[model samples]
Target: MNKETNYQKALHCYIQASLNILNHFRSSVKEIHHIGSTSIEHMDLPGEVDVLLLVKDEGDLSKLADHVRGVGYDEVEDFSTGYIEEVVLRHRYDGYDVNFIMMHHKSKRKDEILYCRNRLQGSEKYLERFRQLKAAYQNEHINGDEYQVKKSDLFSSVMNMQGDADVV
Candidate 1:
């Protein structure tokens, strides 16, 4: 199948899975958000859709996991933090893979979120540099292995320039 068709199918499956989970815990979940590459527009061959289901209390997590299993999703594993528990689910449909990650409200990492948002919204120069590197890698204009090495250096340089390393 063509790339576009594949992406559309993946998106459909993601939305369905998300809705299923949401309906299962409509009363307990405070919010459900679609994050990561799949949520970004024009992204082709995305690894997988990352869904964050935020609940108000940690005790509600087990109920959410049970609800997901009841909806035909196999429970892959559980990830825990001091304030929340994340239940991971994986299922396949028509050779496509879908993943669901249910997290509690307290699990939200504010620092990481803010850092990523800042990087994406930073100065034009940084954005342009990132775009160029991305285009090179996407267009196969450079060796993948070489790009990986250079990309790390690019990130380090950008971080240093922004003094992000000093930020707590």
Candidate 2:
């Protein structure tokens, strides 16, 4: 009777999927993380699961993409950056937004990714503030693209505030 059951279930499956992706590119990817709304504890979240794939060299990205596609995750063109080439994959697992953010190990952008989440999750006040914003946005009944635009604006600002000098 838990309404959050599906969220938890999907998150569990998504984390497992992230582990599988890490296994697929274990040689290149040293550390893989599950970070995002779903990664936040006690936070109401959607079905999207953002994954961080930290590469050791980031030299052979094509091979990694090929291997990712070979594992049934079709590459979706999203999250392309100047330094980091993000290769998000789409799988038919009940419409889960599984993002594969490929970045160099110990890169600034990589650190930023975790830092953004950690900062919000670190403080209950901030977390509740963000949760309220999310609820307000949802109440507005906006489309997904619009919702993403708003979230992107917020997250981009947060990351920018976290010292935009070195982003992995």
Best by TM-score: 2
Reference-based lDDT, residue 110, model 1: 32
The TM-score, computed over Cα atoms with residue i paired to residue i, of candidate 2 is: 0.74
lDDT of 2 at 130: 64
- Candidate 2's displacement at residue 98, Å, is 2.2
Tens digits of per-residue lDDT for model 1, 94-159: 454566666667664533433443554454675566557756876789876766666666655655
Question: Estimated TM-score per prediction?
Answer: 0.57, 0.74
- lDDT winner among the candidates? 2
Candidate 1: count the clashes: 0
Query: Per model, how many backbone clashes are there?
Result: 0, 5
lDDT of 2 by residue, 14-130 (tens): 777776766666777778887767777767656467777777776756677777788788776644333335656666554666777666776777777788787766656667756
Candidate 1: C-alpha RMSD to true structure equals 6.8
Q: What is the lDDT of residue 90 in candidate 1?
A: 67
Candidate 1, which ten residues in sequence have the lowest lDDT sum?
77-86
